[model samples]
Target chain A: MATARAYTNIALIKYWGKQDPQQMLPYNSSLSLTLDQFYTETKVEFLPKQTNQTADSFVFAGVAQPVSPKITRMLNLIRQAAGWSNFARVETENHVPTSAGLASSASAFAALAAAGAQAAGLQLSPRELSIFARHGSGSACRSIFGGFVVWHAGHDDQSSYAEPLLATVDFPIVVIAVLVDQRPKKVLSSAGMQQSVATSPFYPAWVQTAESGIATMSQAIAAHDIARIGQLAEANAMQMHATTLSAVPPFTYFAPMTLKIWQLVQEFRTKGLSCYITLDAGPNPKLLCAKQDAAAVVKKLQAALPQLQCTICQPGPGVAYRD
Target chain B: MATARAYTNIALIKYWGKQDPQQMLPYNSSLSLTLDQFYTETKVEFLPKQTNQTADSFVFAGVAQPVSPKITRMLNLIRQAAGWSNFARVETENHVPTSAGLASSASAFAALAAAGAQAAGLQLSPRELSIFARHGSGSACRSIFGGFVVWHAGHDDQSSYAEPLLATVDFPIVVIAVLVDQRPKKVLSSAGMQQSVATSPFYPAWVQTAESGIATMSQAIAAHDIARIGQLAEANAMQMHATTLSAVPPFTYFAPMTLKIWQLVQEFRTKGLSCYITLDAGPNPKLLCAKQDAAAVVKKLQAALPQLQCTICQPGPGVAYRD
Candidate 1:
């Protein structure tokens, strides 16, 4: 029987706003790239016989600790339906630095999903697997696939799901990770989505316009059109951040030096290098350019914005079994 | 004598952030269309003997009252440097209802710019007029022309000013205002922008990507392509509000009904008719479409969404002399 499985990191080109907080239905359609190289090695065991009043634990990178209160509550809710209340231990090991905030939740949840199913010995489809991972972090929905992926915004519990593009990427795809900081400088917690949903007036617009962007983006990705993908990702990412900006009381997660690096990255594009940038709640500016220009773009961006250390990586495999 | 003069209403296609809040020199490039129907009537007569000590009154419609204390300070700031302490009794009326919350200030100051030039006996070029008007509102800079306009992001006092479109709009345009509500909303009033400037981690990304959107939208508008124009405006507006959502407090101006009308409007386009919606501040949804289909679109929209009352109008005349 197909049970638990580990997924990889997914980046949404069309994302912003969350609808049902518990279920994590996004307000817009989002495109993502599930990568290899980095992942969360996780195992989850759900005990139908454990005691009801105990707490859950998350041991990340050999450090044993109590899980986040919110996560504990979510786990409890899921288990409540099964009439099992004993504690579950979640173990996650990162291929990358745990403190760097390299979107570890995407992988962490993917692993938990795979391991939880293995422990429970319950079979699940890709859609069920995607929905289960969504309980962990919304972006995890895309981690179920490798290569290019798109998350469709369906209305109900059975409606929303993610699908992968079978088309090959002929163009060179590269991500130059400019390391501006070694530690995640505290972004809006995932709970911010729920808060934003309740407060933001711009959230509906974000939801209403998701389909067209997602549809166009998937086409651009499938065609291996670097420019279109970059353009769509940049706009979609910006839209994601913009929805947060329009949220009631308003919030932002930016580093002062982030702007300086962004300028340097775009200056290269404006100089006609065919490069574009995407960011996710961090000061580091990721440079997306052709495989031919990848090294040059990294070197040039490093020279221009020396504050951010650069690391070049290509698209790799999705979540899979380890030898 | 200070007499009535005409000015256009400009809707910017690409506007991201403000470099100087006091002067409203936006950080991004923006394009606009000068409408024919919407205009602000203003009369400016310089009282050479009036001193700065007395309060200058700003009367809306037929009511006469002293300017608000906040505006008094801004006006004083403008007057202190120019040595134009003379009070001008500027009376203004607008086609867009005062409470509708469209950027009516753009028209108010654009007309004031025309009347101010006439009253002050200064034959300023469009750039000079823009500089004077920008002191009032950033959107006012593009309201100087009859067709299309662009505000080139110039740095500092010397280079910054808005200019009319080098290329005019090729298609006849009409705007249908579906009145959702006339009451002013409780949005952050850009307290978020100032806060995000200080707090947002993505502000740099916001600035870096703005130019491309602006440049692309400019070309789209210059070509008079409705689909491109509509796409860019919707995207650009959403981008602006996104930053607001990410502010530390997180907020948005959207309501449930706003999305319903938006869906209906976009549904029209999907049905082979041309109609696109853009919204600001209030819950109202404004449709931009061709003149030939505008009336039918408005009627259809009204019938479709009775919760929203629709009014039809066209691209207004340029700033002109009135009896």
Candidate 2:
């Protein structure tokens, strides 16, 4: 048996739509940072098959759950790659809330891919593991590496994978995630992206901006220009949400509190503190700032919104295996 | 003394950013329908000057108010064009609330332009009147014409003017204005436009889309396809909001109730009603539908949002002298 752990990542630059729906090819490249606070651990064991027995079983949160089609498909890929015919039993533990604004799938799938491959007697490089994890969830590909990571929109499945943008190093970065709502959105990211790609006239512009923005983002990261990176990241997220609003039968991930937080970030900047905000396909708002200002920023935010719950996070390590 | 009345208009294709700040030339052509419910009546008189007296006095809502800078600038333009040195006394009555998500400027400025020109003994055509109004506010140019109107984005001030797309006649359309809030936004339209034009990466795409959409919108209006027109208008307004969100230090006019109404409109459609929504730079939402279904739509909307104050409006006449 092999067990592995992976941390969730927040995409500074967003991936809004897919270029190829079936293969999950993204419309553009994206950059992200894996958070230290949230993660998932998974253990996979190959069991000898009995006559007329279930081929695979997935146990989640200590409850035996039926294998979803997506999970089944991902397991089939691993089985085919490892050249193993034995049935497998998978047990997963999620440290973060599922289907909330948090990126639970990114950590869950990355851990599963790592644990499953090793348990099947297969040794794969991180890049190969990333490709496998992507077969489960697109953003999961980025969870293979920690620190600053970039997922390239390679033309085909063979070429598409994520790698660290820079060596694992401590940067003066901090993210305070403000959880406004933990409920699952009525429109999932998968359905939202499909609708945007099919209907929004400005969707093409978003793809172009996101694809081209990666180079500038990398430069900003290398120079450690926090302001430039934050601005670009904020704009990238806004562009993604823009596609949703412009889509036919428009929708927005913003709960009213989202705008209130957005305005407060600007107010914070006017007070001479450097801070910016980024949102994903959910109503929660995340503030990106320097580590030195994290405490003060959190205090100010708490004073302004007394009921809000915020988590302070920094960079974490890549997916790793345990004994 | 001369008095003129002009109704306010709601842009189906929004005019957010400006191309020429001084001349108020828009970045994109826009289309709008003048509403019958809300308007402004202004009377201008070139009074004889008294020693040591102020050059101009403005009376608004039956109260004597100091002449604002914008009002001063507009009066200067009228004086320069008509070659009058006498001081002017202006009295204005607004049927609609000012700076409260209603296009009060559109009617106020258009009526001022007409009455100002005639009071100064200047005989200008409707096109010239639109050009004069453009100096006051960009959208004001469109209010000089009735029914379906298009504000062409010409290369220069003289060429840029609004004209009736078709002769004044009733169309099968009704606008239900839902007033969610009457409070002024923290960010004014002018500052929002400037910030968006300078910072938003998606602003260029908005300009391109708005320019291209006018042709399709005109075609739909010609065919009297209420559904098509409503869809295009709704998309246009959403695109404008997208630019604001993508701007550096992003901002939004949406209150929580604004989104609630937006979702309710889609719910209305799922029930086999042909209704769409358009929003300006405020928290209010306007629903576009056929007049025949107006009563049923209002009933449903009131049921969902009991506190909402809705006004049913249809097309009205263009700016003209009041007896």
Candidate 3:
């Protein structure tokens, strides 16, 4: 019986823009959390000795298709990292809302990394696993760990890795993630941030600023300073997106209703709830608030910002084996 | 016959975003240079004894009319700043290209400050002279000097001040100002940047990055690092404008033809000339190059992008007595 592994990623400070495209060395350092509630349950069943099994099969969201070039490339990279050779049927059941512009891939790819390696029976530590996962997606490496994970921008490929953090000291912070848009983005993140980096005059400056923000953010998180962390993350996200504005053909991730929710959130904040918000590559806002009021908070947001479907996600588990 | 004192204001970097609507202190810092050619020939004649005379009048672009309340507010600012006891008739001429979105008021109001003071028989130093001008327009304070000038941030009604800069060394760089569109902007500067500053997640990072950028730019200009200066300025200008893209209602300063000129300029740059371009409130691009190559460069641009009537200007005299 083959076993599956699942993981999820939560970035304390997110990464955007690339220093190097091929290597995926980010311009700024980032931190994340690997969750259990949301994950990609991948079960790879190796097929062999059959006469005509030439192509790999992928069943994602009940859609069966031959492995695409991009997915094939990711599969090859994982195989090369693990040194395994076999034809397989790979299945990914996404706990995250697909194409909602959420960090679905952050969890999906992380789980895939864990399950893919385990099915191959290759023993891998979290650090080694992180490096392997990074080959698939930059944010996915951070999802290999629980609590908090910092993606370290080490000198070369070998040195760069993410570490799991146990900052249970500040567990009061609850993340209220609202899935604002369901439409798929017109451009992929790789092409999007790249265009902004090359064309934006603010990009180099943003990169350096994000580095400083990273240091400040870690300290803030360590100190249990929710406001500071939220503020820094909010600022960092804006600066990262500013590069997009300065790109030759300007594009923004904000949807039409984003402003409505943002304003209401700010208004609620003014009423003394000790809350702030941070956004990543999507219009959906993740509200940083006290965990004691997690359930009630979503009710308030749903009533106030009628355009949103808010979900309250607490700190989740680390990467582990499934039955 | 009244004498007109004209001054040309060159944006050292550029001004974007307004923090306060009443005072118009920009969210970001901007440096500028005031020259003699593209200037505002302004004269003020104080008629203390005439009780029936109207307030200040502005003849902009050969169109004469009663001054609007906005201009009146600026005049009241100038009146309070100069501490003038008598009513005065202000006649002005703008040498800055009409509707090009270059720095017109910088020179126009600088000359107004100078000519108003001169006509009032108030002998004021350049620093003292800038007080009256800053009220008229934020950028106008920089026009008090021909070289570099920095506007110091100040708080409400009392402490605000600006002064001319006499740098140790200055260069005569050619600016081929290209005009793209003459339409007045839909959103005003103060309204635009304020919304952007308050809302843009990318703004805080830009603020942090600009600190280092501005510091380096000052040093580069002082060291006469032509390439460095141009590169920094281009980056700075682009970053400054990037904030507009994140505004709730996004604003664009680009004209379609601006891209054509930009492409041609990039082609020239690839040919190894020490030429770089900077843009501000309009679609026009101001190409910075040496005076020696100004003619040839203009010819090259004309051949490629002939739609624009290129105007070549240099570091001329500061606001002063002239024919």
Candidate 4:
């Protein structure tokens, strides 16, 4: 039995499309920053084969639930690598706020991969763990390391993995997660990515730009230039969303409130505030700024939008074994 | 003195980037529908050579104003074509509603081209007039014809001009112009197009897709397929805006109110309303639907957003002499 915890990450240079969907190989390199506020903890216990229990059992938030296909596929890979066929009982606890519109898959899969591998009696390094976690979710590999991490878009499964650009952030950077809508996403990220790759005329440009974006972002992080980092991340996020808007049967993750917040961020910048916004595959806008400006940014946001729920997060540690 | 009036147009297949800025040659062909609701009338009189009146004089909306560079550049082209050096006095009347976000350039420049040429004693064909109008504004060439017009993206000055696709509409189609914001644009359309051409990585794809889009739109218009037309127009408009969002120093015309109206339009469609939306380089959105559904779409839009200003327009005639 083993339990592991991992923090969630938000990509600076996004990973939108995949070159190989089955193998989970991305079309371009991506950079991300792990956040301290939200995370997941998963415990895995391998059970010996028995007559009655022939499948994996899963419990989420203290409620027994049927094993999802994603979990099953992830476990199959683990079993194949570890040379074991034993079924497992998995329990997960998520710390992400309910209805926040933020994705928890990164941390959840990272924790699951670590705990599941350990429970299966497999010894692996951090890089190996990141590669294994990617089988469950592409961004999961980034969560395997804290601070700034880059997931290299390698040609094949053996070469693709994430490495820390700055393992311990020496600068004072902060993120304010602004929750806009609670409704589920109309288009899932994986499905949206596939559609973009197949239909969006701008897909090729996104891949080309993202490669250069990763290199520039690495320099920004190394120099501890918060403004440059924020600008690059904001541009990359907008470019990723642009690809989706041009996809066939066009779609956008921007809700009305999301646009409102985006405009407000621009207005804030015009007023000499140093903050920039980034979004994932959802309507919520996350503002990245320096730690010194966070309080002012949050106060101004609340004053302008009294009903908003804002959470501040800082750089966090990578995945660690709980037991 | 010669006076001419030309109706405004809305592009179903947009004209964005330019392949040649000096001659105003476009990157791809575009199609537009001339509308009866808005128009411009201009009178040009070539003044005899005098020491005191050395340059052109201009009056707009009953007030004398300094001649704009666009007007001067357009007049120069007319003078060169007519083999005359006499300065001109131009008067213009715009019927476009004050603060409405719709552009009047297509009609305004088309009328100027016709009136200026006639006043300079140049007898030119409609195609020749369109070629001259391309000097003032790119889309102005499309205003030379009625109903559905195609501005062919020819390689050089002699070949690029507008021609009537379906000079008379045999089917019922309506456009509902939803005025979302009254603020002036932050980036001018001409500058925005130039920026996109220079910076956007997706521009190559845009040019390629637009050629195919023009061909498909021609087929749809011939079949009188309102749904297909709306779908194509909406996708094309979104793709055009997507390019702007991916440009260096990315910008978007989507104001908060614009996004709200966009969501409302999508919701109306989900509830069985047959309408699609397109936006230009500004925040206002134009919803296209069958004539039978215009009233219902307007009612639903008003009920959802009581403050919205909606204008219903149909296909209109081409440019004609007022006197």
Candidate 5:
């Protein structure tokens, strides 16, 4: 048995659409910041072949759950690489706060990739692990590295892997995720992105601009320009969401409350606050702010939105094997 | 003295960015449906040379006001065309309901172009009036015609003008304007389009797709395909708004309540109601539905949102002189 843990990440320069869906290859490069607050730990144990077990089993949060196809596909790839055929029993423990409206797929898949590869007796490097995790979930590749990470939009599977832009951020920055809605997403990320790629007239321009966004974001991180970093990330997130709006039968992730929180963020910025907002494919808005200003920002946000659940997070470490 | 009245129009395929700001030439052709419910009437009287007035005077809704530069520029064009130079006294009255959150520029400018031309003793055709109105506001050109109108994105002053696509509609179609907010717009249409043209990376693709959209929209109108018309209009409006989000310093016109109404519309459609929504540069959302579905749709919308003010409009007449 092998156990590993990986923290979740929120993209600054988002990876929205895929160039190759079969291989899970992105059309544009992406950058993200790994957060210490939310993560998943997984343990994979290959059952003895002498026992009569036909398939892998999954237990999530101490509850027996059906093994998802994604998990099975990931394990199949690991078994193929190791040349070992065995049904593994996987147990995952998600550490994310309840009803946060944040997806834990990045941490879940990254931890699964690490533990499954080890349990199967494969001595894969971190880079190799990132590549393996990508097949399970595209954003999982970036979770293999901590701090600021860049997932290159390489032409093929062999070349596309995540690398650390900054392994650990030396500057004072904090991310506050504001949970806006607890309902399940109407459209899953994969399906929404597929529709965007197929129908949006602006999808090609999004891919082109996102490539350049990575370089600028990296420079901002190097310079420790918190405002510039926040600006770029906010704009990039908006641009990513814009593609969905331009899709045929246009849709949006902006719930009424989501827009309310965004307006508050902009209002606070005008009131001399150093905070910027970014959103994923969900309605929740994440604010990037300086560490010193986090408390004040949180206080004002709570005051403005009494029902809001805000979690502050700092930069976290890369995936690591526990046992 | 000459008086003329013109009704407002809401674009089905929106004209967003300007190719030439100086000439107010659009980057893409657009289509709009002229609505009868809201209109503007203006009376222009050229002062005699003996009056010794050096500048034009203005009165709006019984209050004397300053003449805007746009009004002056438009009047100069009329004077130039007629070879008659004289200061004019302009009195305008807007007929829209209070706090409708709708811009009356289309009706206002079209009436001004018609009345100003006639007061200056210029015998101008409706086509000539459309070209004259184009100098005041881009969309005003379309208000010179009734029913379905198409404003060609021509190269220059002489080429760009509004033409009637379908001057009269025999089908059963009704437009419900939902006044979601009464607050003034933060970004004016002209400034918003200018910023979009200057910074949005997706702008080029928007221009390309809008050209084809115009053709498809025209065909849809010709067929009296109400569903197709609504689908095309909703998608086109979303695409136009998408450009704003992709602009530098990303912005959106979607207020919190606007999104709520949109979600409600989507929900009602899934419940077998035939309705689609389109938004301009502000928070108000317009619903396009068959006349048979109008009462039911409005009833449900009002029940769901008690504060919503819904105005039902039909196909309107073109610019006409009053007296």
Candidate 6:
């Protein structure tokens, strides 16, 4: 048995559309920061043929679940890669909230990739593991690395992988994720992205912009320019949402309170406190600011929007295996 | 005294950012549909020197208001254009709701341009009137002509003017303006545009996309393709709003109900009933559909959102003189 854990990652530059949907390949490169506060742990045990297990069994959060098509497919990919014909039993525990714009899939798939490969007696590098993990979820590749990580949008399966930056950002950066809604969104990211790529007139430009943003963001991270990095992240997320709005029969992830929180961030800037806001395909707003100011900022935000719950996080470690 | 009435025009391809702020010249050309439901009537009377009036006096909605800087500036621009130095008394009545996402400024300034020029004893052609009107508000140029009007974004103030499309679309298209809120928006269009132009990283691409959209929309108009025209209009408005979201300290005009109306339009399409949704810088949604379906669409929308008030409108005439 091999158990592994992977932390969730919040994208600084967003990944919206897929160049290859079947393979889960992204149209543009993206950067993300792995969070210390939340993660997923998975244990995988390969069952011998003598056990007469016809299919893999899955358990989530201590509850036995019927093997979903997605989980079955992910397990099959691992079996093929490791040359293991035996079936497996997998158990996963989620430390982060699932399906709430928290990128739970990132940690879930990363941990699965790591533990499943190890349990199958395969020794693979992080890059190889990332390629395997990406088959589960496009963003899972980034969860293989800690600190600032960039997912290169390569043309083929082998070339597309994530690698950690040479320069670890020295400044204390705080990411305050304001949980506005915990319910699964009506429009799934996969469905929403497919619609955007097919219909949005502005989509082609978005790909080009995100590609260039990767290079700019790399330099900002290297230089430890928190303000520049935060600004780039904020703009990138907004542009991503823009494509959604521009899609034929447009849609938006924004609720009324989403805009209200954005307004609060702007108000903070006006008072000489510089912070940036980014949101995924959900109503929650994540504020990036100096680590020292996290408490004060959260205080102000809670006072203004009393119902909001903020989770403070910093850079976390990459995927690790346990004996 | 000379009075002119001009109906409001909603841009199918929006004009957002300006190349020249003082001249009110848009970065890209735009097309608009003049609506018959709402209008503004303005009477301009030049006060003689014997009357001892040093400044222009303004009245709106039967209430006398101090000459605001915006009004003063608009009057000054007209004075420079007509070569008239006399102060004027401007009485304006808004048949449309003011500053509520209903292009009230478009009709107001278009009326002022026509009546103000006439009261100064200046005879200007429609093309010349469009040029004068653009100085007051960028979108006002399109309101000079009825039906389908295209405002050519020219390099100089004299070159930019609106011209009626040669192809008069005889299709029975109905525009239903959904009034979600009657109260004035907190962010005025003028200030919002300035901020977006100054800060949004996506503004340059927006200019490029909007420029091409104008040509594509013109062809759709020429072909009398209702579906194509409505699709182009919907995408254009959303792209314009996207720029606002990417603006530094980002803002959105959308309320929660605004998105609800948009979803309803998409639902209409899925049901084999085609309808398109567009919005300006406010929460109100404008639905474009076949005239035969207007009553049914409104009925369904009111059923879904009881608080919504839908105003039905059709193609209106150009700026007209009133004795």
How far off is each candidate at the interface, as Cα RMSD in Å? 14.3, 1.9, 8.2, 1.1, 0.6, 2.6
Cα lDDT tens digits for candidate 4, A179-278: 8887788889999999989989899989999998998999999889999999999888989998988987778888878878878888888988889999
Top candidate on TM-score is 5
Candidate 2 runs further than 4 Å off: A49-54, A97-100, A167-169, A223-228, A271-274, A295-307, B48-54, B66-73, B76-83, B97-100, B166-169, B292-307
Residue pairs that clash (backbone atoms under 3 angstroms), model 3: A8-A35, A10-A32, A10-A33, A238-B201, A238-B202, A239-B202, B8-B35
TM-score of chain B of each: 0.86, 0.97, 0.86, 0.97, 0.98, 0.95
What TM-score results for chain B when candidate 2 is compared with the true chain B?
A: 0.97
Candidates sorted by TM-score, descending order? 5, 4, 2, 6, 3, 1
Instruction: Kindly report which residue stretches of model 1 are placed more than 4 angstroms away from their true locations once superposed.
Output: A1-323, B6-10, B14-16, B48-55, B69-84, B97-101, B166-170
Q: Which candidate is the best by lDDT?
A: 5
Against the native complex, each candidate's DockQ, computed on alpha carbons, is: 0.09, 0.56, 0.11, 0.74, 0.87, 0.46
In terms of DockQ, which candidate is strongest? 5
Give one digit per residue, the lDDT tens place, for model 5 in A1-323: 99999999999999999999989999999999999889999999998888798999999999999999999999999989988788999999999877456679999999999999999999988889999999999999999999999999899998889999999955588999888888888999999999999999999999999999999999999999999999999899999999999999899988999888888889989988889999999899999998988999999999988899999989988998895
DockQ, computed on Cα atoms, for candidate 6: 0.46
Q: What is the Cα-based lDDT of residue B61 in candidate 3?
A: 54
Error of 2 at A245 (Å): 1.4
Segments in model 6 whose C-alpha atoms lie over 4 Å from true places = A62-81, A97-101, A166-171, A215-228, A268-275, A296-309, B47-51, B61-84, B97-101, B166-171, B180-187, B198-201, B215-228, B268-274, B295-310
lDDT of 6 by residue, B66-131 (tens): 987767777787788778788999999988644234768899889998999889877789999999
Query: What DockQ does predicted model 4 obtain?
Result: 0.74
Candidate 4: misplaced stretches above 4 Å?
A50-52, A98-100, B50-52, B97-100
What TM-score does prediction 3 earn? 0.61
Indicate the residue-level lDDT of A136 in model 2. Answer: 85
lDDT (Cα, tens digit) per residue for candidate 1, span B248-271: 333445554665666676678777
Model 5 in CAPRI terms: which quality?
Answer: high
Kindly indicate the candidate among 4 and 6 with the higher DockQ.
Answer: 4
RMSD of each: 18.7, 2.8, 9.8, 1.6, 1.1, 3.5
State in Å the error of residue A138, model 1.
9.0
Ranking by DockQ: 5, 4, 2, 6, 3, 1
